[model samples]
Target: MELTVGPNQFFWPAEKWSAFYRDLAEAPVDRVVLGELVCSKRLPFYQDCIPEALAALTEAGKEAVLTSLALVTLNRERKLTADLAAMGVTVEVNDLTALAHLPKGLGFHVGPLVNVYNEGTLAWLASLGAKRICLPPEMPLASVETLARAGAGLGVAIEVWGHGRLPLAISGRCYHARLHKRTKDNCQFACEDDPDGLEVRTLDGQPFMAMNGVQTLSDSYACADYQIEALAAVGVAALRLSPQSQGFFRLCQSYRERLNGTSPAGTIASEVLRRLPGTRLSDGFLTGPSGVSWSAAPAIP
Candidate 1:
């Protein structure tokens, strides 16, 4: 199966953002989707670096696609969505508003944030010129199998969210600002302080969610270490790995090794845990009773 690196969701300094993509151009991934997928306000901070980054990825022999903002409400944001299609790169639609702006018959991609829960939606998107669709992270494996099968007939490649903090929701209001007693407009970009997003704890101090400006994410990182084979067996074409703040290039190599069958899934999972020590990992949304549940390593047959 092919591996794709999704857009960066955090608010990193311009240098850090540029370096991430520059490093990714050499990472062991097939395709790289770059551009601002979170708050549009963060775009200006690193927009200038995008062209060079895209060129680097292209020169390095990787398919580079630009991603639409997950929520486009402002006029400039709408214009940004409209202009992405003209950039001469594949546009990954994270919000449906982008569809209205894409030129007719122009093939595009769908990001995991969009609600692609059923085959009908998948087929409809394919009909509208979506060449590839990354099923939402919350989808169960059975639904994934059904869609993958349908996509096969329609000639559209099906992908799934293989890793990263699950993006649960996006809002017009910035939760990070609200947490700091500021309004969305003048919130001073407080979300940048926590590059990976601030951890939200429950009353009893249980980790619940992560706040990244307007986006709400699961505290536990969603992993597909155990489901790679099952998904490949189901005809899923690719796996998307969302860009995180740390060890991402190595993370790409790890997933690539697992996909190539050079490394066992258990070893990859253990390495991830060892490298990202305090983080919890889960694949329950794909094969469990809850999104936070982690299936134990399968016994060797």
Candidate 2:
């Protein structure tokens, strides 16, 4: 399956952001989705550097797609989505609100954050010019296989969340603000401190969730190392790798190697465990009762 790096989910510095794309240009990946998918306010900080990063990735013969904001409420955000059409790049719609602003008959992409559950929704979106779809991470394998089959008939490529922390929910409340006892409007940028996201634990200190400014993710990264064949067997077009602050480009290369059968699944899992330190991997969404279960043994290759 092809690999497409999702937009960075954290508030990393501009130089780090640019450097990640620079590294990705040389990485063995087919596509890259770049742009801020979280809070719209964070865009202005590094907006100037996106064009150079886009150019670099294109020059490397990689297909780059721009991502619209996951939550768009303000006029500025609406304008941002509208202006994306003029960027002359493929736009990945993270929110349905963006479709309202898109110019007529322009093809767009559907990001994983958008709700594309049933065949009806999928068909409707394909009619609206969605050439590709990254199904929501929360979807079960049965739903995924069904969607993948239907998508193929519609001439739409279907992708799935292959790895990374599960983005469970997005909220209007800025948790970083609540943690520091500040309101959303006047709060300082507290989320910048946690590059991966601030870990939230239960009362007993068991890690449960991760909190970004307005996004909530699972503490453990969702991995599909063992289920690659299962997904690929059912016609999944690609796998999306969400960008983390550390060792992300290496992470992409590892997956690429594993997909090509040049490396083992355990090798990729071990590579992640080596770098992240005690970070658990889950494929429950694709194989278990829920989106948090792990397999005890590797699936047969």
Give the alpha carbon lDDT tens digit for every residue of 1-301 in model 1.
9999999899999999998988998999999999999999999999999999999999999999999999989999999999898899999999999999999999999999889888888889999999999988998999999999999999999999998998999999999999999999988999999999899999999999999999999999988998999999999999999998888988899999999999987766788889878888899988897888887634347
Residue-wise lDDT of candidate 2 within 1-301, one digit each (tens)?
8998888899988898888899999999999999989998788889999999999999999999999999988888899989998899999999999898788888988999998998999999999999999999988889999999999999999999988988878898899999999999865888889999998999998989899999999988988887888899999999999988888888888899988999866777888888988898888888787677876445558
TM-score of 1: 0.97
Q: Residue 222 in model 2: shift from native, Å?
A: 0.6
The count of backbone overlaps in candidate 1 is: 0
TM-score to true structure, per model? 0.97, 0.97
The per-residue C-alpha lDDT of model 2 at residue 21 equals 91
In lDDT terms, which candidate is top? 1
RMSD of every candidate to native, in Å, equals 2.2, 2.3
Cα miss at 107, model 2 (Å)? 1.2
